[model samples]
Target: MSTTALIYEGDWVSGTSQLDEKFIGYVESMNRSGGLKVRVTQCDREDAVGTSVEAALAKVRKLPDYTPSAPEELKDLIELSLATHDKEWFDELSARLAAPQAAAEQDEEKRYRFTPYQSRLYRIAE
Candidate 1:
């Protein structure tokens, strides 16, 4: 058995209308798939300012013996979301994800940055 975890921010809406409806549908489909678990935590205005995807990833990396379990497909979805909704942030995230983790971690004091919409998704297979 193995489990994979994905933590990132989400943008449910751009204004009054819903955004990422297709992505939402995909998540619903995953829920119906039985082995997937999704957890979404909405950040308050203040919290959102202080939190970021990089910070989230950095925190996850700092966990004792922690490793990301998200499949390449899921990661691609995230990349797509960033590319569509937040190009600047996506550019930063893409560079970070592509960078070697070992090199990034060497600067232990580096701050993890992310957008306002933070989310975490994971899957367990048995």
Candidate 2:
């Protein structure tokens, strides 16, 4: 396995074992040795759920972020925020509902700078 993805604590990941067992969860802790402890949120094996499973960094990838579209969806999210007592999330959801186009534009923007593979990204002046 290649260390191509950046792994971090709290990232949602799916860990795969050598035996082909898979566990989905958020990373609880990351070790400098390229292993991590994952608090299993789900697994094919019933007993593994809610247990911490150890795995190598190469076996996991961060889950992509999700953005709910539509006024109804945003409203539903606001309700979830209220239920969870997440005031910051409530505020953000409300703002998104109020200005959905702006939020959509932001979502379309690149999250990070990209450089073409095998190509120089900078120019030198004489």
Highest-scoring model, TM-score: 2
Please, what is the whole-model Cα lDDT of each candidate in the order they appear? 0.33, 0.80
List candidate 1 segments past 4 Å from native.
1-74, 82-85, 101-126
Candidate 1 local lDDT, residue 83: 62
Candidate 2 C-alpha lDDT tens digits along 10-32: 88887684445698898888877
* Stretches > 4 Å off in candidate 2: 1-5, 18-20, 70-73, 101-126
Clashes of 1: 8
Residue 54 in candidate 2, Cα distance off native in Å: 0.8
Least lDDT summed over 10 consecutive residues: which range in candidate 1?
Answer: 17-26
